[model samples]
Target chain A: MENTTKDYSHIKGWGIDADPKNDPTYPMKRRTNEEHLGYSWERPTLQPQTVEILHSNERPNVTAVFGTSTPPSGLSGMIRRLAFKKTENDYGHWLPLILADRINVVEGIIEDLRSGHVPNIFAEKGYKAEWKYNRGGLLRKAAVAAILSYGVVAYFRAKKKRKHNY
Target chain B: MLAMNYRGPLRVRASQKPMPKIEHPQDAIVRVTRSCICGSDLHLYNGSVPDTRVGMTFGHEFTGIVEEVGSEVTKIKVGDHVLVPFNIACGQCAFCKQELYGNCHESNPQATAVGGIFGYSHTAGGYNGGQAEYARVPYANVGPTIIPEGMDPDDAVLLTDVVPTGYQAAEMGGIQKGDTVVVFGAGPVGIMAAKCSWLFGAGRVIIIDQVDYRLEFARNYAQCEAYNFNEIGDPVLFLKKETDWMGADVCIDAVGAEAAGNAMQTITGRKLLLQAGSATAVHWAINSVKKGGIISIVGVYGPTDNLIPIGNVLNKGLTIRANQASVKRLLPRLIEHVQNGVLNPKGLITHRIPLEEVSDAYRIFSEKLDNCIKPILISPSAGL
Candidate 1:
C-alpha cells in the first residue's frame, strides 16, 4: 500500500458505513452456521505436484490441484518469484511479473530460432485473421509499424552522414 | 470427439480429442448440445490469463445432454438435457449450503478466492471446458440443472453463464428505485447488465465502451444510453458531468482485465504485463461513482492483483462487491425472466457457427468482425 498523509474527512458522508448497522447489506447478509455441514463424500486425493507451482505469498501452501504444463522458467520465472514476494496489492508485485511474461515470449522465439525452427509470427499473432476480418485495424497497425521503422532508419542514416561531415 | 484446442495465446483450433469420461463417482459425462464462446474465454485465448495450457478445451457456458452418470449421481440421469453452471460446486460445502456456490470451499480449494470455474484456466481449476463435443461434469448433482421444458436451447446455453452473470452484476449493485447506473464495457455481459439494471428500478442507465458497433448494439438491445469512451474525453469527468457532478449511484465494471481506453493501463497491464490485464474500467468506476455508491464487478481479471485506486475507495466510503456469478443461485429467477419475455438471452446471438469452425468463430469474435455480439457453437451431433 502506498503511504498517504492526506485527510479525507472533507469528503461528504465519509465513513458513513463505518457503523456496522449502517452496512447496506446489514439484514440481508449474515453468517450462516451451516458451514460445519461440510463435504459429505471423502475429499478427492490431492493431485501430486509434478512441476514447479507458483503460489501467492499470502498462501501457506499451494492449491491441491494446479496446472503443471507451463512451469515458470527463464527470466520470467525469476521475476514471478520476485512478484510472489510482495502481496498481490502492490505494483512492485505485478509490473515486474508482467515484464517477465513479455520477456518470456522473446525467450520462446529465440529458443525456437536456436532449434532451427522458423516461427510463423503472422499466424501465431493471429494477424492473418486480422487482415481478413479486421482489415482496417490491421492496416492501421501496419502503417504505424512502417512509419516507425522508416523514422528509425532515417535517423540512423542522417546520424552517419553527420559523422562524415564532422 | 472434436474439441477446440488451445494452442497458446491468440490461437485455438478444432481438433480431435478423446471423449471425456466420468472421473469421480459424482461425475457425469455430458455430450454438449449448445456451447457459447464467452468474453472471459477471450482472456484465456489472448494469453492474458496464466496457466492456460496447450491442448486445453475452453468453453465454460454450455448446455448438454447427459451421456452417462456415475454411481453416486442420482439426481441426473442419462439423456437428460442439462444446463451446467460454469461453477463446479460440491453441494455439500458450506458455501453451497448458503447458496454461495461460486465460492464453494470444496471446489478449487487451492485458491483462496473463487471456486472452480469450467474452462477458465488452470488457475481456475484444471478442469476441461465444454467447448468440446463432450465434457466431464464433476459434482453433477450440485451444478447441473435440467433445462426447463420448452425452453429454447439457445436460451438454455446462455443461462449457463451470461444471463446469470449479468443479472448477478445488477443484483450486487443493490440498485434502489431510480438509481442512476453506469455500466462499463458494452460486451454481451455489459449489455445484459445494462438491461438487467432496469429490473432493479434504475431510472437512468448508461453504458460505456470503445467499440462503436457494440455501443450501437447496446443502445438497441439494452434500451439504455450508450457512448464510446474513446470519443468522450475523460470517462470519469464525462460520467460525473452527466450525473450532475453527484456521480452515478451504482457503477459496474463489466470489462475486466482486458479493458481499453487508457494508454498507461494498456502499456503496463496489457503490453508490458505489469498489472493483471488493464484496471482501466475499475479505475473509472471508482472515480465516477457517487461517494458511498456501490461498484459491482463481474469482469474477469487475473487472480493476481492489478493497479487499483484503494485510497479513493476508502475516502469515498464506496462499497465494492465482485465475484464469479453463482449461476445456480441466479438461474431460477433468470429462467423466469427469460420465460416471461423479460430478457431475451438468445436475442443477443449474432452468429451461429458449427463446432468445427471454432477457430473462425474465435477470430470473428476476438476481432469484433461482422458486428459480432455473441457467437454460439453447434456440435456436429447436436440433434443426435
Candidate 2:
C-alpha cells in the first residue's frame, strides 16, 4: 500500500493524459487563473475541511472532513502545489509541515481498511472441521491399523502356500 | 453567510473569516454548542468525496443552543437546545412536507435541485456546514429539535444520527412486531438498529459482524442473537436456518460500506459482492431478508449500478427504503429512552479522545485498532 502511494503520488495530476500546452508547467497541464477558481468550487478534492478546537461549553466536538483528502496545513498545501501539482498557490512550501501533517494522516487512514470482508480470527471456516484428532492420536491409530493389515497379509500368504503344497 | 476552503483529510481548520449576511428573513443564527465527526465525513477522508475549501466547517450532526432567531421564526426561541438533522429542508417545500428534501421542490437552487444538508456532499445540497463554533441555520423552524434539559450529551449525541438512524434501519426493513430481524454489521447504525428493533418489538434480532468486540458490545443493548459472519459458509442459508429455513423477516444492512468485515474482501478480492462490504448493504438486504419480508437499507451506496435482481425483488415481495436518514423525527422519544434508563446507549463508546486527537482517533477507528467500535469525540465540555 505504501508503494502504491508512492506510485500514485508520481501519477498525481498527469494521470494518463499529460499535456504540456494545457499545463505549461511541463509535469501537469496548469489551469488558467479563471479555470482554477471556476474548478475549485466544483472539484471535491479542493473542498475545505473544518477542524474544531473544543471550547469549554460545546457538547459535540466532531471534526468534519467535508470533501477532501487529509486536511494538510497551509504549508503542505503549498508543497502539493509546488513540488507535486506545481501550482503557485497562496500556501508556501514547507517540507517539514508535509511530513508532520499530511503523511501520517495518509498512512493512518490506509491502515484502517479491513483486510477481508470480516475481521480476522474466525477466518478459517473450513479449518473448524479439521480437529477430529490430535497428532499423537492420529499417529497411534495409524500404527494400529498398519499392524493389523500386515498380520492379515502374512496369514493369507501362509495359507495360500500351505494349500498349494497339500 | 460563511465560506469554506478545503485543505485535506482530517485537516480542516476554520478560517478567521466571515461572509455576507443572509438576505432572507427566515434565517436564524445558531451558536453551535457541539459539532461532531460523521461517518460520512470519513468519505472525504478516503477520497471518495471531495470538497472545495478548508475554511468551511463540514459537520452536520450537532447539538446547538439557538442564539438568534429571525422575525418569522416561532416554533423555536433563543437559548433553546437544538439538534440539527443533516439537512436544510424548508418546511413549506413540497418535498419537505413530503419529507423528501433529497429532492425538495422549493428554496433549493441551481436548476431547482436540492442542495444538501449542513455539511455534506454536493448532491445533497451545498450550504455552510455547522462544524464551527457557530452556524447560521436556514429554515430554522423545521428540523431542529429542542433537546430537553438534564439530558447528557453522550446519550443525546446519537439523537442526531444513530438513535433515529437505528429506527430508520428497522423501519426501512418494514419490521413488524415479532419479526425476526438480521442486521448486517454492528457499527453505530447496526447496534442502534438492533436496539430500535427490540424497541419496535421484533421477535429476534441477529446482529451479524465478524468483530468479536462489536458483537460483544451488541450483547448489552440488542435483544436479538448474534452471528459472526466469518463463522458461516453461506450467510443466506445460515440466516434462513436461523429463521427455520424461512429467512429473516427483516434484513437491515447497517454496515454501510465496510460490510461483514475485511474477510469478505479477502476471499473475493473486492468482487465478492455480498460480503464485499457495507458499500453493498443493499445487496445483502435483498439477499438476507425473507421472500415476503422487509428490507430497511440504511447503508449508503456508492456510485455503482448493481445489477439488482429485479426478478428476485419482484419474486420476494421485498420492501426497501434507503437514503439519507431523518433522525430529527425520533429525537424526542430517543431522548426520553436515554433519560429514562431504558436505553443505555453509552456502552458502545469504545474510545474517548480529546478532539485534537481526531487524526489519531480516525486511525484507531479505521484500522479497527483495539477493536474500537464507537469512539466519542470528547471536547472540554464533555470533560474527556
Candidate 3:
C-alpha cells in the first residue's frame, strides 16, 4: 500500500514553499517567496553588506591625489600645476585653501601655515618672505599677479569708455 | 504550430503559432496529442476572467508525448506518453507537498487567486495553455504522470481535469451513507459528481438543468433522477417539496459564472461584471440544501468579491467547501475507478475536432450547438 499521508515538513502554510531548493527556477519565479504570496508584508531580513561611503558624502580625511607621481590630466592638472607647490611626501595637496584665488598667494601661504602644512618654498630653503628669497620666486609670482590684475582692470575700463562714447 | 487565438469575447480564430520551447530548467516541451476545450475555458472566452490577454491560446485539459526535457527535468523523459494536470505545481512547494497542488506558489506570478492553470488567463497564472501543437510544461516532474500502458489517451486527458474536479465535488460534500444529494448544472462535472456521489453512498441523486438533453443524459449516464428547471417551477422550492420541505442533505454547485436564472443576477454579474459570475446557482444551492448540510462548489468564479448571502449561510449553518480540485491527490483512486470500469471519464466527450478547428469547437461548445457536451481537439502532429 502506498503512503497517502503527506510529509508536511517542507510545507509553508498560506501558500509558500519552505524549501525551494529542488526547483532550479524558484529563484527566478515572480511569486516564489512568502512576501510575494501575500503571506507576510514584513520587509526582507537585512543582509550584511559592506557600507562604503558614496560620492555625495563628505570627502574622507586623506591627502588629495593631485601631486602624486601620476598626476591627473586636463583642467585639474593645469590648476594643480599652478596653485600648490609639490610636497616631499605629496601631503600638502589637502591644504584647504587650494581653491583660493591665485592673487591671494600670501593669504594662502599663511592659511597653509595655520593648517599645519609647511609651504614647499619655505621647507625647501628657509622661512623668508623677501623678494630675493628662494631664487626671487616670490618676486616673480608678485609681478605675474600684478600684471594679470592690471591687464583685467585696463580691458574693462576700455570697454566702459566705448559704451559711454557710443 | 496552429493554435487558437483569443480575439475577444465570443471571438476566436485558429492561427499559426510559433512552437513553444523549454523556458526553464524544469520545463519540458510536450507535443499535444489530445486537448479538450474545458467548460472553464468558456469563462476565459466570454472575457469574464480578468487579464485574458489576446493572442493567448486556450485549452487546459491535454495529454501528450514529451518531445524534450530540460536539464533539471528528471522524471519525465523524451517520447514518454503523459497526461499533464491543469494546475502547474512546483512539487517541492509547501502546498504541493501537502497535496494542495492547486495553490502552488511559484507557478503563478499573479495574485494568489489561483495556482497556475494552462490557458485560463493571467488571473490563474499567465502560462499559455495546451491548445497548440506544442506546449511547455513547467515543473515537469511534479505534474505530468505517464499514461499507464493500455489506458486510452482519451480517458487520460479527461483525468487531467474534469474527472478529478467532479470527484472532488462529491468528496467535498462529505456525503454520509444514504444522504440525498442535489447537483446544480447537468454539465460534465455535474454528471460525474452525481455518478461519483453514488460511490460515496448517496441514496438518492438528483441533477437539475434547463437543457432537456443534458438532463436526459444525466438520468441515463449517472442513473440519477434528472429535472428540467424550466419544466418545473423554482428548482429550490421543487427540491424542498420533494424532500418533505426539509431540503436535500447536500447541494453541489457545478455551474459557475455565466449561470442563467435570476434576472438581477444575470444583469449585474454577467452583463455588468459587478459580482463574480452570476450567483444564481450558488443562491439556489444555499437555499435548497437542508440547514447544516454541506454545499460543495467545484465551480470557477472570478477573483473579485461576489454578492453572496452570508446571512443565509450563517442562519442555515451550512458548510461550504469550494476549491480547484487537487488533481494529484485524487489521481490514484480515480485511476483505479477507471481501471475497474466503474467510471468512464471519456464518456462525457461528445465532439472530437481537429486542433485546427479549435475556434469552431469553442463556438459549438459555447452555443450548445448540436447538443455538444464536451469537445476534444485532436492534434495531427501528436505521435499517437
Candidate 4:
C-alpha cells in the first residue's frame, strides 16, 4: 500500500506508472465482437495498384525446354510433339476451348431442331459440321482446336480397344 | 502529456503520458479542455467497481476541443469544442437507434453487461478517459455534442455526465405535479436530482445524506430540504412522518454501492466484495417511498447482484426505474433548460484544479475534504 501523501510532482505527465501488461487483472475482457462496432483501424491504401499480365502474341517454344531435336520418323516423333504441346499449353488453354466446342455443338444441335432441319444422323450434315472457334492468334486457335480434336480421337480409340477386349 | 493514473484503491498520480492518436475511422482525438471527478468515479477509485485495471486513467465526465477527426467522422470537425457524453455509443446500433444510447449493442460487444463508458474500467469497454491532455473518443459523431454558443465550459462539462445523470434520475421518478420527492445521497447527482425533480413538477423535494456539509450544500444549491441521516433517527420513519405517514411520492437512490448507512451492507457489499457496493440507499429508497410510488435509481452498482430488498419492493408495488443516463436522448431538452437558465449545472463545481494535481483532487474529493461538492479538472493549457 503506497502512501497517499507521496508527492508525485516529479512525474511529468500522467500514465507514467501505468503498466497494463503487468496488472494482474488487467487487459480486461474485451468484447469478442467489438470489431463489428463500426470502429476500424484498418487503413486501406488510397490508390490500389492494378497489375496487368500481358500474354504476348509470341507463342512459347513448346519443345525448347525438353530439347529441340526431333525424334526419328513417324509415331514416336508425333507422340513427342504432342506431349510437348500438352506440357506447354497446360496453363489451362485447352480446357476452355474443349468446353466451348461442346457448348457450340449443343447450340448447333438446338438451332437445327429449331429450324426443323435435323433429319440426317450419318451424312455430311454431321461429319462436315465444324466447330466455330473464337478468334485468337490463328496459330494458337488452331492448336486449341487440334487439342480438342485429339481428345475426341483418343476417346474413340479407347472405346474401340475396350470393345475388342470384351 | 499528463493524465490521471489509477494505481489502486485511493492511489492515483498524475504522470507523463503520450498523446492519443486516432485508433479507428470514427475516432476523434480531443484535446481536453475540462474534465471532472464524478461520484460514480469514486467506485472505480475505491476499487469497488470490479475489473478497474491499474494504471488506467479514471475520468468519465469531460469536455474538450477536437484536435483531430477520423476519416469517417463528419458531424464534428477539428477545432470544434465538444462535450463528450460519458457513455460511448455507436449511433447505428439497435439500442442507439431507439434512443437507448447507454445500451448500444455495437459500441461494447460486452452489451450483455454494459455499454462503453469513457475511463470507467474494462467492464465499460476499456476506453481511456479524458483525464489527460487528449483522449481518443470513439464514434465521435454520435457521442459528442458541440458545446453551444455562449455556454460556459463549466456548464458544458457537467452536461457530459453529472447534469444528464441527475436529470435522468429525476426523469425516471415519473414525478407528478404537486407530489413530494425524496432524493437520497446529497452528492452532486442527488443535488441535481433534487433540483431536476422540481422541473418535473414535483411540488416538494427533499434530499437525505449523512454528510452535514453536503446536506447544507444541497439545501443551498438545490433549494430543497436537506437533512443528515445521522442527525435524523431512522431515515424511512422520518420521511414517513414528514409525508403524513403516506410516505414520499417518489424516492431516488443517487448513492450506489458505497453507501454508508447499514453495518451489514457495508460489510458484505463494500468490505467483503460479495455484493454490489452497499445497498443502504437502495433499501432506504425502497422503504421510504409511498406504496406503488416510483423509485428512480441512477446510482451505479457492479454487474454482480446486490442484496436488495426485492420482497419489500414487490409488496409495496413499486415501479423501479434504473438505467445509465441516456445522455444523448435527453440532451436536446437539457440544452433548452440550460439556455433558459432553468438549470445551472456548473453551480455544483466547488473545486477546480489543474490536471497535474488530479491525485490531490481525487484525495480531497474522496476524503470529503474542504467541503468539496464537485471537483472539475482544468487542463493545464485550457486557460480557464
Give, for candidate 3 chain A, the lowest lDDT window spanning 10 residues.
A62-71
Residue-level lDDT of model 1, residues B1-384, one tens digit each, is 998877667767776778876556778889899999999998888888754555578888998999999878889999999999998887665666667778766556334466788887655666778988899888888899999999999989999989888988998999999999999999999999999999999999999998999999999999999999878899999999999999999999999988988889999888876667899999999999999999999999886768989999999999998878888878888889999999999989999999887877888888888899999999897883
Chain A TM-score, each candidate? 0.66, 0.21, 0.25, 0.23
* Winner by DockQ between candidate 3 and candidate 2: 2
TM-score of chain B of 3: 0.99
Put down candidate 4 lDDT per residue, B17-79, tens digits, no spaces: 667776567778888999999988889877766445455687888888889998878899989
Model 4 stretches with alpha carbons more than 4 Å out:
A1-166
TM-score of 3: 0.71
TM-score to true structure, per model: 0.82, 0.62, 0.71, 0.70
> Listing every candidate in turn, what is its Cα RMSD in Å to the true structure after a full C-alpha superposition?
6.9, 19.4, 28.7, 32.8
lDDT of 3 at B114: 64
Clashing pairs for predicted structure model 3, backbone only? none
lDDT for model 1 comes to 0.81
Best by TM-score: 1
Residue B323, model 2, lDDT: 58
Candidate 1 CAPRI category = incorrect
